[model samples]
Target: MMKVMAFVGSPRKGGNTSKIVNSICTGLKENGHAVEVYYLSELDNVGCKACDSCQANKVEYCAINDKMTTLLPKIADADCIIVGTPVYMLQLSGITKNFLDRLFTFYRRSNHTARYLPGKKYMTVTCNGAPAEAFGNVTEYLNQLFNGSFKMKNVGNIITGNLTNKDDILKQQGVLEQAEELGRKLS
Candidate 1:
């Protein structure tokens, strides 16, 4: 079974973003893929320091000793990475941005290549109060990061909009089902 790492970037517990992520994880588990979910809002993760330490390979990991350091190995070991976020100001949430920044360790400045992360499968789930078309650029940005910069395979993306309340997503039909289907297809 493939290992899948899922990150929830919303601060609200039981929010729309987490519901989508949890649905995807449920599908991954049903497909017999090992799945681990991390709530970025609750983690002590920090932004990239840009110290060039990981680039130089001076330390075996990111120099920052935050919670993200512990998650680095899990990220490296996973066969797929799932990122879920709530759109904020036409972009990803702050915590999600910080979490992405911390992934700099995977980039080797020496060769200008991503280390231990290339060729991995990647997916994203984004929920916004605005219409889905309003944030196509956000989705494109994520796609470019995973498929272009990181050299990862773009498996799928679930972009849902008009979800303001924590339970609004549940009221929408087929969105969560689509997320589950996306997860199952990943396997």
Candidate 2:
């Protein structure tokens, strides 16, 4: 079974992003894949220190003595990863941005290459108050980071917009179903 790790980057527990992520996880679970979900806003993590400590140490892991010290290892080992975020101020929320910044640990500055992330599969979920097309840039940025820089393959992105409230996602049954199908088809 695939080991899937999902992160809800929205602080709202039952928000649009969380609902979409849960739908995806539900599909993966039905397929007998092992799924673990983490709420980024609730997790104890600090932004990257930029000390190059991860690249400096022989082990090549972040030196931060927080939750990520352990979580980063799990990320490296995960077969698939799902990241869901709610757009804020035309960009990723602070919580989501900070968590992604922590992923710098996977970069090996030595040879300008990345380690432990190539070939892995990743999916992104984004929710916004504007129309769906408004935040393609946010999803594009994430694609470039996970697909281009990390050499990870993107399964697909679930981009939902025109969501005024959390439960508005429930009205978008089509989007949720698409997310579920993605997880079910995930290898």
lDDT of 1: 0.89
Question: Which candidate has the top score in lDDT?
Answer: 2
lDDT tens digits by residue: candidate 1, 67-90: 899899989889999999999998
- List runs of model 1 lying over 4 Å from the truth: none
lDDT of residue 44 for candidate 2: 69
- In candidate 2, how many Å is residue 175 off? 0.8
Candidate 2: residue 29 Cα off by (Å): 0.6
Error of 1 at 67 (Å): 1.0
lDDT of 2: 0.90
